[model samples]
Target: MNQRIRNCAAAAGLLFTAMTASAANYTAMLTGPKEAPPNSSTGMGAAFVKFDAASHVLEVDVAFGGLLGTTTAAHIHCCTDTPNTGTAGIATETPTFGGFPLGVTSGAYSNTYNTSLAASWNPAFLSSHGGTTAGAESAFAAGLASGAAYLNIHSSLYPTGEIRGFLTGAAPPVPEPASFAMLGLGVPAMLLVARRRRKA
Candidate 1:
């Protein structure tokens, strides 16, 4: 048992060392509020976005109140990395909410968000949203591994977004596999330690 315990400990230590060697778990966040510009029937729009580095999943939550008249449509555009509305692309290769609001208007409209699809997107999207406010998770890795990403908000009146932000920072970066190795090894090490201590 002692030998087994020691072996497990050694294994765990090795794994921890390897895992700690690197880390990953980045996240970028952005919000859209009434502060949006007066482009749509309303004056502004509101939005909430969260990106998961590991899963590369993007979760979005947006609400536009005080609409000029009612809701029409909205979008996450890729305009600029720096804050403010710019002329960019719409990098929503995959979407959560394409161009429709969550029923703010009383007219014909529909929104489609596939929960199964990964919300994580390229920097182009983030730049469109706003470099300062828009956010992306795992985006840093994708950027380092590929490039950057951004976000943008738009409406019928302002088909060009009214509010925008960006996902800045090196990003949380991907977690080191070694840490996972540690977690895997640690479980056994802890079990062994507990058994030995209890044995006494």
Candidate 2:
């Protein structure tokens, strides 16, 4: 009985570890009202971000429309003093993200950045976060997880930001087939252990 319990516990531990090792995902809904010192602009947007800690890569996708003025720049800010409010400096590429549409009222963008490279980060942000790519990655990931990071879209009319939203955790990616196999084995073992204990 004791050995059976130990086997079930080991299987459960492996299942939990496998699930937690996957990448992290976050999302935001951009709007004028979410910006600091809110504006009356009619623009709205949405951003989806994914960070893979194993590979040190970050993926970003954004879509926006209905702006009062043409777009100028877009990037991410991080480590705000408070979550869901306040403002912070840029943590991503300066001026704007690479390949971002300029002088456009509405557009869509998708890009992947290698966080292990200095070019993917703002110089000031890297310096402030311990002056290393690893340090910057750690800090930025923490900010996103804590709701202290945001995606901002600047327009000609609103230089500060026409629309912005704080990043929040999104639904996790689908588990791999191996994960399901692990679950299948672990759950039955757990159930068997429980049945034996009840019979006893």
Candidate 3:
């Protein structure tokens, strides 16, 4: 019985480690009201972001419409002083995301960034965070986890930022295949051991 308990605890530890190492998903509903110093532009947008710490990959998707002015730039800002409020400097590519739609009131964008590369981060942001891609990646991930990261879209009408939203949501971690297999075998074995002890 003691041996069985040890085995079960080991399996649980494996599962916990695997789950904690997985990727995270985040989403935001962008609107003028969510913007700092709120606007009345009637524009709306949505953003979806996924980050894989192990792979150092960041994926971003955005859709927006009904803007009062043409699109100018869009990027992510991070490490706000307060969560879900306030403003922060851009943490993503400068000017705008690569291949982002320009001069359009409504558009959709999808892009994947290799966060391991310098091109994926704003120069100032990267410099401030220990001047390395790894440092920037770590800081960005922390910002997202703490609700201090946001997606913003700038327009001709509101160059500072017409519509924006704080990114929220940290998906439950998923266990790796090996961890799943361990749980599958360990759980049944644990139950069998318990049943035998009960019979005894």
Candidate 4:
């Protein structure tokens, strides 16, 4: 491509990236016996969560193993005063994902939720937050960022929770205005280099 076109394309790409960069990712390692609360039996599992601000979607994936009995239910619990401690005040919809029964002793769980879809959220969460979809999402996101969220798996043997782990990760930082300017300025520099090379 010619220098002019190349630079213009580069500039456009940078602008596009800056406009579409507001997603967050997080992970939790669930060790049943390791982090189990008092009187709970030991088990192990893992959970992953993704949140996209632009799409207003929250995705969850989980896997469990070594439970003493069949799984009764599972959920992403949150807003604890401390990380990995205290009884979870709110929980996501049970079974996390549809089509998967909570009876499996070892298996995977997956669920996709749109923050605007009130049906996908726990009723208690909505009530305690703002009784609205946006309100619940905002509160949940804040808790996640502060490490107050956690994943909890319950079983027939332990109705409360068999294993658990706290969620920990930060959202992607917003790009500074100067960063955009630097990116925009690079386009002209590239164009100048290309022009010089062609002349030589």
Tell me the TM-score of each prediction against the true structure. Answer: 0.39, 0.75, 0.75, 0.72
Mind giving the per-residue lDDT tens digits that candidate 1 earns over 42-135? 2322233333343344444443333333333344444344343334454554332454444342211223333223353434555544442234
Off by over 4 Å in 1: 1-42, 79-85, 93-151, 162-200
Most accurate candidate by lDDT: 3
Each model's lDDT: 0.39, 0.81, 0.82, 0.66
Candidate 4: where are CA atoms >4 Å away?
A: 1-20, 34-36, 39-42, 170-200
CA RMSD for every model?
A: 15.4, 13.3, 14.1, 14.6
Give per-residue CA lDDT, model 3, range 1-200, as digits (tens): 99999999999999877854666778786778888889997776667787876788888877777788899999999989989999999999998999999999877787889999999999999999999998998899999999999999999999999989899884323334553343344333433443353233
- Order of candidates by lDDT, top first? 3, 2, 4, 1
Q: CA lDDT of 127 in candidate 1? A: 54
Q: Report the Cα lDDT for residue 47, model 3.
A: 72
* Error of model 3, residue 46, in angstroms: 0.9
Error of 3 at 89 (Å): 0.5
Cα lDDT of candidate 3 equals 0.82
Error of 4 at 67 (Å): 0.7
Clashes of 3: 0
